[model samples]
Target: MTRSPATPLPPPGERRRLREAGALTRDQLAERVGVRPATVRAWESGRSTPRGRSGEAYARLLAGLAGAEGGTGEDGARASAPEHSEHSGHSGHPGHHDRRDRQKAGAMAMAMAMVTVRPDRRGGGTAGPEPSAFVQTPPPSALPSDAPDAAADLTPAQAFDALYSFCAPALVRQAYLLTGRRDLARQSVERAFQLAWDRWPEVARDPDPAGWVRAAAYEWALSPWHRFLRRHRQPEPPPPDEDDRALLDVLLHLPPPYRRTLVLYDGVGLGLPETAAETEATTRAAAGRLLHARETVAARLPDLSDPRELHQRLAELASTGRLRSAAPPAVRGGSERRARFWTRAAIAFTVALIGATTLTLRTAPTRYEPPVPPGETVQGVPPPVAPGPLSEEERELRARLRAEFPGGPERLTPQAR
Candidate 1:
């Protein structure tokens, strides 16, 4: 019998993550490594895998950037999990099959974890009150409806699908909390996923693809376009639940980074280290943001004495029962949208600048008057009035002090005698 062809290996996700972690854009990295930008993009996208001399050089560059000894094992082997194929395994090699199976099992477990969305069982099927109708998408239950049973010997697309199906709902809910606008929040989440889909090769290899997407969604939800858009919108009544409405109101008042740090840490339950990674902040900086967020939240909700309880309550308030799991909408006319955004932003900025200039001109202190020549006064300006005669006691005291201290006269009389 003829042997089946081997499955193509998936691109290592670390290549992209490390490049990002190292703060090198694709073009920058390509320039540094003496390669075409397209080559680097290909390597990152897994369209063309790097190996041998090129792979080693690529790994070394990334490792150096990441401050690691090597991006691969000691022997310079790829660190990514080995790709296994059910149809291509040898029947005679039982030991090899067993090892491959074990690896597949571990990979599958990770894949499942990436997508699993377990609801709080303690609520006893009492799902939290529904959010505003526009905000409610679809909720993931014990298992996402689209999740594959196992990730055994899966392709990159399969892996990405599994991840997207599982995490999109939670991500949308998180975006909604950040933006407080249903349409904007949904758009943010969709845009994030769209980017992820386009870079699935890199995303597939990520340790926490969902976390990556969540961070992106946070940025998108908080974009400045929302501020400009708000000017044209009529305000709507707040959500019905007093606790939730109050929590959201407080969240909206927070600085964007502080709010993002809070959502990622307390609301999403991300560890400090991962939170820092996702936020592109130093661990110290991320901690400080989290601290400020908590203090602000506590100050706003004084009845909640315990910070942990406040965190819990905020997390609950952020939770939703539904999210849309469909594929992200296609991104079309991106340049046009960006142009419109910049145009609006510039107009608003110019208007504000003009208004500020007008106010400053109207409210500025009266024009700085030029000093008068010794014998001349300014036009339409009054001269200093002559002083009244000193009282008897003042003259006597000055004379006495001048007699007692000869230098005192010089100090007292600004003009020399």
Candidate 2:
């Protein structure tokens, strides 16, 4: 059996007239049509057309309204009929479907473009571009508030998940190449994502969100401080393949800056300028580092002379290891947990400081106190005199008197004696 023809919709003007004639609000019609009120407005204004199930339902509703309005609906349709017929003549017409496709394509292109070619973010005497890729330029919707209306309907969490899903796995591998430590690589990606989640609105609005995350991850992986971490100090088991192991060892041996430049340019395929900007070095310095790194690698491994071979080998090395990133939800949860911990810590510290200040203010001396002066030695003070043998003439008499009194004292107390 032949398939039935799809339901037909009235002309845009007729669609609105029929709806008005039936006394239905845009909201009411949108609800019946299973779309947003904005969608209904778009339909009536001819900015967008309904399609598939929604379109068929919309057509059925219009047909019913046209039938109900009877003669008035008929006259209005006759008036707008030519335009609608012409508009629909080319199925999925440019003014109709092709227009939508172009719109969708345009939005995609814009998003992609936004992800690349960010302006230099470094501050200087002259104004220019930057990256984190490197800066953001927010509507408040959890993610980038100023993003296209296409993403307007999505919740912040959904948008975050989309970004996380797209960027996380690849980021893990890149982090591994930068640090030469699988666990550290995983940590770097997770921490970066955690940070991204914490500052989601800022990250979402960034010109190149993936690049922003990449920079964060790479920074963590290549940090000088990681050398101090207990887990990172010990060299982990090497790659299984001899070549892979040798390549990884060479990568690890390179100075962090050179390693990063090589990875960014050859492995991740970033431009020299981008690598330099990300590394916070001049373009020349970046070029020199990259050259030095390539030379070092070629010196160690003669077979991998070509840059292409090196790049391919690097990719293979990263792939050989089983590096994995945490789920987006877990990362988001961890980030929130960390944020809350720090928030509590800050609040506690603030409260404690305030209490100390208040206590000090209350108990502190209101006025300056004068301290007692210290005593100093006085000049020419008289010394104490000793009785010198009670004068020699008196000494004999005093001794005789004492001898008599000694015995007389006992005799004087006659009752006790």
Top of the candidates by lDDT? 2
User: All candidates' TM-scores?
Assistant: 0.45, 0.59
Tens digit per residue, CA lDDT, model 1, 1-417: 432213332335777777755645555676777776557766875777665555556766876765653443553343322322322344345444455454444344544566423233345343332222212223333222222423455655555555665566667777767767666666787778777776777877787677677777888888877667764285635665565677888888999889888877666655677778788999999999988888888787774445544544554454532346456233323423655788999999999999999999999889697888578655987878998999999999878886875554345547677
Q: List the candidate 1 regions with Cα displacement exceeding 4 Å.
A: 1-110, 115-155, 230-237, 320-417
- The best candidate by TM-score is 2
lDDT of 1 at 375: 84
**What C-alpha lDDT do the candidate models reach, one value each?**
0.62, 0.72
Clashes of 2: 8
The 10-residue segment with the lowest total lDDT in model 2: 131-140
